[model samples]
Target chain A: MSVQHVKIVKNVLAGNDQTAERNRARFNAAGVLAVNVIAAPGAGKTSLIVKTMAALGARARVGVIEGDIAGSIDTEKVLAAGACDAVQINTGGNCHLEAGMVQRALDDLDLDRLDIVFVENVGNLVCPTHWALGEQLKLCLPSTAEGHDKPIKYPEIFAVSDVIVLNKIDLSELVDFDRDFFYKAVRALNSHAPIFEISCRTGAGLSAWADWLLNQHPHLDTKTERLHHLSGAPGM
Target chain B: MHELSIASYLLESVEAQAQELGAQRVLAINLVAGERAGIVDDALQFSFDLLTPETLAEGAHINVRRTFMRFHCAPCDCEYSPKVGNFSCPDCGAVGQLTADGTELLIESIEIET
Candidate 1:
């Protein structure tokens, strides 16, 4: 037998990326704004979604894809709160949600009737940052209770996020959270992501975030509008 | 971690390439991963060893090459590798944009017995 060295230069995640692109196309065709919300557990991901739904009211029909290691509790909570429809994905021990799981979850929702879809990724700061779920925006929610050093500890997630939400601002003083330190750490890794300080419990600073979300909706009425939306897409 | 899935994909790529080359058994796989690739090397090796049994790559060895995350400071017109997990430029203290330099996870080559 002869020993041979075969060159096979390829990305391991290319398959998942292709599926993500396909999912993006599907969302675009249906004219739905998809946002992937990621954070650590107890970081107020579900709270933020419920609050956003309440703020949106009848303006948009929203659907949710709740990802967890094992439970449908979040799906039920969103449906009770105001989501038009919801789907739950139990990863069966996986720490992150892949594009294939999102693709399957999309089948359960009526994309034509929905205007927005929120994918609550399994609470993780590391693994989920590597997988693309074909989201138009990636929102990172870090609570004040978690401390200000999260950006320094989990720089990849902060760097990849399109928007950063500092939740639990109401407890900022109680926790002694240093705002300057947090902002500086985040800026070190990502200078462009807009940071929003909001208290989900008190509904403070929700309107600004809601308005920003509304502006991101691709009201694809004409060719010019489509181009305008594409031009403003984050990380595109 | 997601290293199991990554290992599965890596094995699939090796098997496809090995089959195309008409190889009987794979001897080793050379992989290049960046520091931010989000994979633990030990976990990947464990997954590979667990999955490679009874396959063409049953006894294959995995060789990993690590790359550091590099960035280009546009204002300073220079490229530099930031300190681990800190992406700001060392010289100017500016948030430099990432270059294509370090975000690669490529299957560089495979050593096989034909």
Candidate 2:
């Protein structure tokens, strides 16, 4: 028996990362700001999307991509909440949404008509942090009810997230969430991103959240923006 | 579930590399992962076992070595792991940042038989 050793240093996720870059290029071509929303189950991802869409109104053209383990319930809600268009991606049984799956979903959405696309990632903190879907921003939601130590337990997710959304603060009175501990822990993981504390059930802190969304995509304010509604360009 | 996906990528890359070298089958592979890489070794092995059935990498052994998260505390100029779970320097208990030592996931080498 003859054997040989071949040495190669390559990232195991190279294929996925390359595909994500392609997805990002596609989104850029249409001037769509893509946001990947990740969180643990029941972290209020869908509620935030719904509220953001309603708040943006005519301020921005928004599309929704609902990712679930199996079902179209979130898609139905986004459509009802007035998303310019929406795409539903069911992971079947996967714990997370990979770049290839996001690529396939992008084919169905009219990216030219949208300013920002929010991908509601399949609820799982650990798995979703590894995959990138060519998104310009990654939003991570950790409900205060879920406890403050989440940033420590799942540090990788918070470390990579661009925006940390603290949801369900409406129950801060009832729940024993330590605000100082959570911020300090999150700072250990990530120090640059702004942490937004909001209650999706009430409009307590959504104005600032929506304002932050607008700042992410400044093209909405520029007249030079290649808007599908204002221009004759077709969706790529 | 993520391991299964990772194993698929590893197998595909190994098979492609093996074929390029005119090898008929692959025997084993060495994978190096850093402390912050966030992968489970047993889960990766289990997925590799189930995924290599019909590929050129069938029956191949996968060896995963994890490089622990290393940090250097500047406050006391000490180097250690995050003992307190938040970059708390083990030597002097000062907060530090993630070092480059154990943050990468790499496919080191592969063995194949002709």
Candidate 3:
């Protein structure tokens, strides 16, 4: 077999990046602090976000954009948990939520009346991390049942996460989960991220996490004062 | 794996590049796959072969350049390669704090026969 040489080129999908940038600008303009919550199946992402919305409901207005391959249970749960508004995006069979999907979902949310908007990504660590949904914070949920080596095994997801939530800590002792090993794994991939050990079922260690999230309000940033100029009315 | 999507992107890029260079058929495509990217080389190649047929890149060879994961010590400023599944800075024992060099999935170059 003869080897044939071809041209070399480096070009990313500029269209996707442009859409993400526009989403970011729109989110900033609406003073909506969006977060992309990612994790594996059975990681308690919905439970954690529901608990967070309940805890922060009195302090701040919260909205939710639930992305799932099928079923509206998460959307119903978010509404029942007392979010100002909740919308669901069904990706059919897609493993992750893309920027275009999020843009469509944004039209269904009232951007002005919310202080925080959480995009609960589809439960798969690999696919979600590759897609940017215009969220300022990228949160990862690693349940104790998933083992301590997840951060090392799936380094890309952990690397992009601004915060790591170690969920199902209530069962830490029942299982052979080692806190030190998990911490070491996370630190190896991401050192600056603050890891919150919480139990969504018991509502343990959630207040501190909620407080940290509240502090990330766009209005709190002096450099971006324009974020606070949003009207209280719903945009969508 | 997500490598299927990356392969699709590569095929699109190669087709576009071939059109830009006024070439009718693509011969090979070069890609860099970092060790930490979680992509299976055999799986990607299989998917690429299956997906590229009947397209402009039919029967194109795929060349993957593997790069090892490297981290820098924050305190000592020493760069070190991490052993597979090991993520610590060997020089300062400061943990892996530097940005990762691996985990890259990009189309580097494409060859086309005019």
Candidate 4:
């Protein structure tokens, strides 16, 4: 038995990170701010996004990409909430959405007409964090129903999230959830990411979140011109 | 399980590495799994066995190095490993305000036979 060794070092393809880069560039070029919202099942991701859309509707033109293993309920909700456009992605049995899926969804959206695009990922805390969908901001919604120890258990997700939404705050008193412990866990994983405790059901603390989101909108006026030039190019 | 998908990626990475090194087969693959990664080693091994047949990593031994959750206390500046269900800082009596070190998932190295 002979032995040989070779090296072809690479990161696993949790998702198409390179394509995500391209998507980011495209979003930037088109003056669009894309945000990826991730959470576990029943974490109130849909409700929060709907609330966010409602809050931002008066100021920003919002679009949404709804990802799920099956069903279009969330997509319907987003569209009905007055989003400029809503694209539904059914991933079959896949646990999360990848950059490719978002890129494909973009084909159905008019980037010029929108100021912000929200990609609501499939409801899986572990898998969704590993996959980047070319969003400028990544938001993780951890509901009180899941308890405060979630940030401790899933540090990577919390660490990578630009913003952490402590959803279902209205139920915090009823549940055995600790607010101090949640803050501490989040601080440990990420000291910089802002934590927003909001209840989509009661519309508490959502305005602050919407205001912060507006602040993060990429400089679209410059990108819009750049994209206009690119669109005019012969090959493009 | 997501570990199945991870195992598939691991097999592909190991096989590619083995082929590049002119190795006939991969003998063992070592991985470091963090306690909080939510990956089950037994499930990963089961999936690896199912996925590695006819590949360079076929029948290879899967060695998983597990690490427990560690926390750093801000008040005492002490680093301590937390016990299950007790997420408090051992030195300062502070609620474990620090992050756990056990969420890592990586392929450390592989041993192969030419």
Query: What ranking emerges by TM-score with the best candidate at the front?
Result: 2, 1, 3, 4
List, residue by residue over B26-84, the lDDT tens digit for candidate 4: 88887778776667888888989999888888898878788776777777887888765
Tens digits of per-residue lDDT, candidate 4, A12-124, equal 45336678998998898778999899999999888888899888766777899999999999989988888889999999978888788998998999998788998999888
Instruction: Give a tens-digit lDDT track for model 1, residues B1-111.
Output: 888878887888888888889999999998898877866788898999889998888889888899876778888999998786466789998877766565678899999
lDDT of each: 0.87, 0.86, 0.81, 0.81
* Backbone clashes in model 2, listed as residue pairs: none
- Name model 2 segments beyond 4 Å from true: A223-236, B84-86
The weakest ten consecutive residues by lDDT in model 3 chain A span A220-229
Cα lDDT tens digits, model 3, A1-236, are 33346546463344455677788888898888999999999999889989998777567778899999999999999888898999899988778888888898889888877778899999999888977788999999999988888877888888878999999999988888988988887777787889999999898999999999888786834323333445333332
Best by DockQ: 2
What local lDDT does model 3 show for residue B19? 81
First chain TM-score for all predictions: 0.92, 0.94, 0.89, 0.90
The deviation in Å at residue A102 for candidate 2 is: 0.8
lDDT for model 2 comes to 0.86
What value does the lDDT take at residue A139 in candidate 2? 94
- Give Cα distance to truth, residue A39, candidate 3, Å: 0.7
The complex in candidate 2 yields a DockQ of: 0.69
Residue lDDT tens for model 1, A1-236: 99998888889888889999999999998889999999999999999999999988766778999999998999999999989999999999998999999999999988876778999999989889988999999999999999988987887788788999999999999999999888877876687899999999999999898888877888734433454466774321
> Which lDDT tens digits does candidate 3 get at residues B3-113?
666677667777887888777788877888777666677877887888887888889888888887778777877889876677777665667664668767667877777
Residues forming the 10-long window of minimal summed lDDT in candidate 3 chain B: B91-100
